[model samples]
Target: MLPSGAFVLVVIATVILHCNGAPTNCTITLQQYTTIQIGWTQQQVTQFLGSPGIIVLEVGTAGSPYQMISVQYSALQSSSATASFLFMGGSLYTKSQAGIDAGVYTITSQQYTMIQAGWTRDQVTNLCGSPGSAISESGTGNTASVSVMYTVSGTPYASVSFTFTGGQITSMFEVGLSPPVNDKITLLQYQTVQIGWSQQQVTQFLGGPGIIVLEVGTAGSPYQMISVQYSGQQSSAATASFLFMGGSLYTKSQAGMDTGVYTITSQQYKTIQPGWTRDQVTSLCGSPGSAISESGTGNTASVSVMYTVSGTPYAFASFTFTGGQITSMFEVGLK
Candidate 1:
């Protein structure tokens, strides 16, 4: 009951299929297909794997102009052991093989959009491809963490960092752009005023202090301290204080008062730490309203700077110097 030419056609098809010179028992491994990647052109794929056994084209609708193509090849010398590659707009979109490891899978934009917190590390790797870097840290008693960072192509300032705890993502965030620098004084200029710097060197870096006072201790005693104050920017109600022992830089501090035009925040007040130099404090809170100095016998001296949060007075910061170095400092709020 077979058609007239069907028998002849069967013989011809069998010969064509078996004449490729491949052994019937041959097998292919997943590593052999890893050369394939997304965004490869049709010509590139053809050059890599030779001509495919089947080529299929899906016509586009009136609304969509781009067409899709599928190229299929038989692996392991068996027709059933096949691999399929999908292409869109003449570029490879995806590939899959039967009974062979595909290596690490790749993801599409749609898959990346679906990533969410509470996903396991394995799920993220399978859905978004391998990350560029993975960092792990150990915590106390069964607490350990990992962070995976991914850099997207063509984006210079944007990246993704995913934190994992106990094999599940604990947090995820996108980083874009660097923080802005707010340093009014340049580092090079600041470094010029190192410890033991002479008064002359200090003046060269920052001009003359707004106010200067010298305290003299008892004769034959090494008690001597110099206090200096610098005005801040015209718009800032902050002031800077510098203390010098034996004519060398010792300690410094800054205080800010509330001005009708400028107000100091609680965060700014917390930056004032003991032992900080005058320049370091001023850099944080700007300037102060006034600076004063006092001296006593036996080489004891102190410099105090007043700050106003508003146009009214608010706090006083004082630094005590001994043997030409800062020994103690404190701040007190006004009643």
Candidate 2:
């Protein structure tokens, strides 16, 4: 039998070797092969870890090593993240210390963890560990004071922001850079269009604004390509412009230059119904189409309606509305 001191050392070594390094006692909803043991091959890993969320194979180079597996997990209906374990010299190592450090975490049954905005934060002691680190302060009046926050950076990395109300975490801000502009909007939100009925009518029926951008058809098929641009610089310029080809919203940069050139249908004097009321136009076109741009325009304010009346070159009619009123209406055909 091993001596007491020898046994203690062995325990310490095992803890150092296998511990994920996550916050002790914090539970991880997404488990990575709870029964993982030694001598398991890559194929065995698949059967064990659910075939990995994603697999990337690359040719090995002199400096670099062979391709490895990258596993990712996501809370239900939430964002996803990657945790890569490099297969260096045929041995697996957590890609970074963050992974190993975070791996040590264990959660209790009383507390719950949430992976919001791509970072995980649990409301528990191990989460903050001890006192939080301070990060700038703002606000005034009754709710004004210094604010302290905690940051956990490592594999399964996270940032836990605590908003204090009398030194309690009244609210939380899981800090991470805002997602890429294109990623912020969904495939549908990128295609949404809005039209307003009337100011009062809007209040009566449509309480608030929440619409998605959706592509109607394939590009180069007389369909207007619609997309959204999210630039921190244009926070105040929430405007939505339309490209006429097939009623698609034009996503342009602050310079008003087209970011999606190939997607935009080239045309001169593209009929625009900008600065129109929704009630007026919806009354004409049945219902104001979809308000696509809220910060910019086209939010329950207009619709990109395409109606080709029987005629040479197909007489195309377009209407713009605001507050249910026809702000602009026009038609054109191949001359």
Candidate 3:
């Protein structure tokens, strides 16, 4: 099939909603933030800081009681100076400096690569070399879910998180780790792929029967979900993150991917904007940006687009959208 005409976009686990023309000198300080009162509307806080804060994390849909959003601002170039604002129901409730302080450096990028979404808590602890700290828990017994965090040391701005239900990871996220120089996908069964291979054929070549992570439509139909993950044997972090839909491979990716994913430009970032439909942005750029990641829950869905420049100064940008319209964005080095 030819590339789709348009796509919805948003950030990953850590949503990056970048604002064009946002004031740069408005980062918050731990001491300065202590003086800011709670119960302030986001706009009031923005006015106090002289800049709008960048939304770094969002959970739940708007107006939902469980909805939560975390925004990060530029700070002093010191590890201890890191800070973020928490808004519950659109009002500032608290502020935090989450990583680094809590031995966030306990997990490394290589360690993170070995863990899978459905892996048990013990499996993760064994691989990561430490029992991850449980930050929150809900439900009970088999229905229980726990959220854990592992901050990577040395790098002041990176951490890994896992949310487990029934003792298996349901979702995971990482921050600040650059995709490896060569994402471990060279030996992926993906290279030997044919467009429409059955699940059995895929399992036969890929060694393991990839699990079915999602399903919809009918039981005995063509839209079944089957996903198989293959990793490199040498520990170069070679991993093939791909999936099969309706008995055919439809999505394929590898770890540490950094190229062939960007499609937006600096000029477009300035022109294309929130509330614009995917069709509108595609029309402006003449191409829909390549999608690097996607995730959704309940009423919210997000996709990522990495736009880059060709020469001297390479850059990357990610914009968020829902209901097929742009809502927010994040960018680095676009010129």
lDDT of 2 by residue, 53-169 (tens): 333343455335564443333332223322343343333433311221223332211121221111122334455454444333333344443334444444234454444443334
- What Cα-based lDDT does every candidate model obtain? 0.52, 0.35, 0.60
**Which of the predicted structures, 1 or 3, would earn the higher TM-score when compared with the native?**
3
> How much is 50 displaced in model 2, in angstroms?
61
| TM-score per model over all chains | 0.26, 0.25, 0.36
Tens digits of per-residue lDDT for model 1, 199-303: 567766675433442233221223445555554443234545556676676765554422223234445656656666555555666764243433333444454
Relative to the unseen true structure, what is the C-alpha lDDT of residue 328 in candidate 2, on a scale of 0 to 100?
64
* Candidate 1 Cα lDDT to native: 0.52
- Regions of candidate 2 where Cα sits further than 4 Å from its true position: 1-127, 136-144, 155-158, 177-270, 273-335
Best by lDDT: 3
Q: Give the TM-score of candidate 3.
A: 0.36
**Backbone clash count, each prediction separately:** 13, 59, 12
Candidate 2 versus truth, CA RMSD in Å, comes to 19.9
